[model samples]
Target: MFAVSGGGRGDGSWPGARWREAIALTLETSTIDNTDNLEPTPEPLHAGAPVRPDSPTFAELGVHPDIVRALNEVGIERTFAIQELTLPLALAGEDVIGQARTGTGKTLGFGVPLLQRLRPASADAENASRDVPQALVVVPTRELCVQVTRDLADAGRHLGARVTAIYGGRPYEPQVASLQRGVDIVVGTPGRLLDLAEQRHLVLGRINALVLDEADEMLDLGFLPDVERILRMLPEQRQTMLFSATMPGPIITLSRTFLTQPTHIRAEESDASAIHERTRQFVYRAHALDKVELLAKTLQADQRGLTMIFTRTKRTAQRVADDLADRGFAVGAVHGDLGQGAREQALRAFRSGKVDVLVATDVAARGIDVIDVTHVVNYQCPEDAKTYIHRIGRTGRAGKEGVAVTLVDWDDVPRWKLISDELDLGVDNPVETYSTSEHLFADLGIPAHANGTLPKAARTRVGLDAEHLEDDGRSGRDRRGAPSGRRERSGSSRSGSGRSGSVRSGSGGSSGRGEDSRGGPDVADPATDIAAPRANRPPRQRRRRRAGALVGEPATDERIGSAEAHQSPVPELAGQGETTRRPRRRRRNGGASASSQANQTVDTQDAAAS
Candidate 1:
């Protein structure tokens, strides 16, 4: 790539000229365009689902006045391409498959209609009490479930739509209580939604509309079976709306199987690519150790507003966010490791400009539609082209200019090459660049003498310290150290408490004060006393004395077998010293060796007890 000037996208042209091209691409001049069909008023299966006459605001799209006021309350007035296309059909009760890139307002596309149909503004728009949710939204991830629910709730504020979000890693009591009280709409991850429906807590027989948000993510997460099972539970006569950034074969099959004569509508996208037109992409071959250094410099670039950094794993996301925060950038992280409340806290702070940089793993980043994100940094190479598009799409949203930088480690070259070939990005071998390299400064328009750290004076005043997040009402293993979400409901941390058999543990499970999990109580061991589910147990305290205690034991193999049989069936009780949420460590060798090693440990423990 030859570049004549600094800040040029290799051709000495900034995104301003190209942004016009994007506007032209997304905002069609003709008001009569119907996307798949050019007809002004395309006929639908239902007469009630009518196409509205040309008008500027959402009110003209058959959205109710109260809901329109709610959209305005959130500072959203005008409609986007997807909203323009999908709203009319959806409001009229027509099935729709909306395919588009992320950040194109797909939430409002289906949301506007879902609210209008479910909570009409006439008499019930302001009513508080509602029975048996009329709508259900199934999403891929917990983060997305919360996001969609929030968006819909915001949009339905005036309409009094009781939108509730439910997902795994959360206690079932709150959700069950909400369902019992009755809700107007429920947005949830597939697993939790299915669970609630089966328990008869979430009724689907009366569901008027079902939304499968982010179908591609659902497929990637292997939730299609759950999705199919969920769809099967809904009323056959209901409206179905499916939205995805990409439409793969499985998604197509799902649509064919579940949707009834669904009309495919796309916005802010071309079938050739899902990458945004307003984003300038740069791929660089950077040293793995020094990628952080490069990222620090990039964050200092002029106009680098609310940046997003993508990592492959949950651990990496936390590490990067911590590293950036230490460098004096207002940073927050989203990943599986953080509690739901913490994740939402980070996202909210980022959205409010209290934190301008968001570090995230792909699982937690789906359906994150924050606006004004100026950059997306791929801290790790994406697995495929689809993922790359999704990451960078975080920036350049709603037709704004954004810069996407990918720091490709040497080992990731082959995978990067594959993605580049698939997307025709033309940078299969990214520029061999370092943190202090001139090309980096020239390409990103970084100020001269900019180091890998921010100046004390340049640090933003609003940071994570200045932001406050609501509790997610989580406890124990799933809490991930976040404050509880429902404090009023948390008068007692115990939801459903029952006593099982008295638990017995070895000396390894003793507390520092000389009491064990099963000790006769002068004071009961809090761990066993709580009697919570194994999945919600606290971090164990066993590993510290494991090898020391085993060396003193002398029992034979037969005693180990007997001890193992008498051990608690709940795995948490057996290993009361390990964190409940983490996976059980597998041995380095094959299964037979692992079994042998396990038997030896058990034999040693049994002998020590004897």
Candidate 2:
């Protein structure tokens, strides 16, 4: 049996006495069963059944009353399976390895305990004066960083716990300034967090708790080295927690090396499928060129709200979004090719109901948790089963039913079969379907008369342009359609040192440097000094000279028509005190002629005489 005593202050007036009493009673009565009998597997704590009326609330789990109140205010009273298993061990300062499927409320599972253990800024004078973070949560992607920061901030609002998010693609000045102002918890990606820590801007020496969320994703993205470096910098006595959906080999080794006697908890049953049972999935064989037409009809399905379309490449994501928007559908795109401001703008538009369709690539869509998503469409076949699971996991979240459709081209049929076999999806050979196919309409609940374009009456939602893009303080070169990296030649004057020389600008022309009224070098105004047109300029003349004297008239003259007049003069060679022209050699039957030899002998004699 495990037990934890809870109290906020040392004055003996227990602030969480009711919750502690409830936790003690539950721990005493409940019998925790070890579901997995495999050797080397830690005893797993199961929540038994899904969340119900009799499920334990945050208060009953001995969570801080302030956190419980904040969670209740947001209509989150009962704990999910993962949260129920994690809260007790984590709140007691024990290291925990939490494994759960996506959208199983993993953020709050660690967030609540992390917030409860930390001393809030308003309450702790010593820690507040130091302005060092008490807890750190590291995520793999920028999207996840934002999501976790928002969740933790909402959960710790009543406790006055300051939370800040730090990630790449945004200006560093703002994040550094936020850290300087002090925060109770910091949630960030590995790259940006390590950069700040190496620069001495972030202080991790005083951290009391550390969490690596999405551990498997971090390993896949090759962030384990930076994560390990960060872990080494923290105090050794602090508590560590790791949460991931899948446990690969590297993650298991990581848990063994860093975590101390950690309790392994799996929220779901052992025999359960990796995919959420509530999600309804369908697969179809589609053509490469007809994919857009097929996806358009899928978006028009009955009762479809906030659909997400996934593509394999960044170009395809943007292309699908453009095609949909051209067909009068409100759509936005999130991919690697877009600027950070544009990506955030698309997500904001999608979340605010401004855009009903969002097109995104795999990496860009990581950690996006948008509720109310009724449909997820795979515009192209996924690479493997894991990607397929992650893609469909976006829908069917939080115990909601969702519809997922996959369109596989002829070339990707083999890949799709492999994924189907791995997951036991039983859809090995997909039905060959097209935009006009009757079964597609029946499967996804599309109207019988639906076409490739959206109707005028259904285009009521505002488009992506309606969302105001925030200025991320990036240079114009970072924006799309902006000028290249080369600086443009402007008419603005530039001051130079007091010297007399031609000051050449980047326009490939020399600007005359003259004295101004103040006796300083005058800068040229490019706007007023436009070059003359070629037609109006005088024709250039060419003259021939030999032996330091003009030998022929201007070559442009009509009188100079003979071949001899057009011949080039021999160049004069400088001797000791005389100049002699070298005679030209003539090849006659691949040998020197008698006249050429005689001219050469005369030139040599002339040089010897000088």
Question: lDDT scores for all predictions?
Answer: 0.66, 0.71
Model 1 clash pairs are 49-92, 471-485, 472-485, 473-484, 473-485, 540-577, 541-577
lDDT by residue (tens digit), candidate 2, 389-410? 8788777654467899999999
Candidate topping TM-score? 2
Superposed on all Cα atoms, model 2 deviates from the true structure by an RMSD in Å of: 13.8
- Window of ten residues with lowest summed lDDT in model 2: 492-501
How would you encode candidate 1's per-residue C-alpha lDDT over 1-610 as one tens digit per residue? 1111222222322222211111113332111101111112221111111122343588766678998776665445667566766777788888887766555567778888888877442445433344777888898887667667766766677777788888875668878998878788888988888888898888887788999988998999899999999999888999999988777889878877888766666554552333445678888999988989999999889878888899998768767776676676777777765555455556666766777888888877876666567898999999998788778866664435789999899999999999989887789788899998999999999999888777878875467545444444433323422223311111011111100001211211223242322223435556566565777767664332233332222222343345334322222323445423222334545555444576787889889999
**TM-score of each candidate?**
0.67, 0.74
Looking at candidate 1, the ten consecutive residues that score lowest on lDDT are 491-500
Candidate 2 error regions (>4 Å) = 1-50, 120-126, 269-277, 476-610
Each prediction's number of clashing residue pairs: 7, 0
